[model samples]
Target: MLDRDIAAFYGVETKRLNEKVKRNARRFPNDFMFQLTEQEWSLISSQFVMTSRMKRPKKSLPYAFTELGALMLSSVLRSPVADETSIKITRAFVAMRQMLTFSTLPEKVVTLAQELYKLKEEVNEILADQNDINESTRAQLDAISTALAELQASRSQDATLKNRRPIGFIQPKEDEE
Candidate 1:
């Protein structure tokens, strides 16, 4: 998380939070907190829609605190509100960790794809076995099969996109201009 975000959560100004971090520098190692490089900041800004404050000009890059660094903040900030906010932050971190450990979205998507494939196969079999089918009925069955194929193709495309990493910014082709 960013220093400004942590300060907001703790009900303190960003300057004050940085001050506290500086005073207790020994508590936070390089891994616990670090400043974002200009390149990293630019990439992140381009990839994400940030608030006005974040987009504002600044002399230096903002500090990013790891979960341990955020936890260390509670010790440095001795206010009741800060303490309460720290507890919530800690809980959020724990929940995120747990969710990561037990995530099933990919598995669920695979299962759904398998089921759709099976259904498609069954539909195809039914269409093939229908010897006495009228023209309208055959057309309807063909439409259903087409729809299922399109749905499967769409799902596969979505899965591929989801797995692909996001590129923050791309230059437009000169030919397009």
Candidate 2:
């Protein structure tokens, strides 16, 4: 997670969050919190749409906080909101671990299964809508093709008519008339 996101979750300004983190730097090891490289930042920027205001010219890259670092932030911030948010974040992390390990509670497993079914149904509906769009697009393309062919034929006929000589004798130029 980026420090800014964690700050937002903790209900603090990003600069204030960084200041707290810096104050308690000993709590965050290099692995827990580290600055992103320019290359890494560029790659992330390419993958996501960043706001122009967020694009500041900084001497150093923004810091990335690992789960441990995020947890440590709650302790450093010293606010009730931070504490509650940290607990929720911690629970989320534990839930993710449980899901990955396949050690989810029975109730959680049932909920997950239901959610999966809902997702599957949604995907099927989207595919059906896409098929309808495909058919409509095909019809439109055929109409365009027919129109182009007609236009081309008309243009060819006009060209031939323009190039053809008159049935009678050639008319004199304006100067001769």
Model 1 over residues 1-177: C-alpha lDDT tens digits?
889889989999888899899999999999889999988877776776654445445666789988889989999998898789889989988999889866977788899999999999999988876754667688999999999999999999999997676666754455359
Flag regions of model 2 displaced more than 4 Å.
52-55, 98-177
lDDT of 2 by residue, 1-177 (tens): 887778789988777888888888899999789998988877776776654235445665678987788888888988899899899888877887778777647778899999999999999999999999999999999999999999999999999997776567776354366
Clashes of 2: 0
Every candidate's lDDT? 0.86, 0.83
Candidate with best TM-score: 1
Clashes of 1: 0
Model 2 worst lDDT run, 10 consecutive residues: 51-60
Please give the RMSD of candidate 1 to the true structure. 32.9
Residue 53 in model 1: lDDT: 44
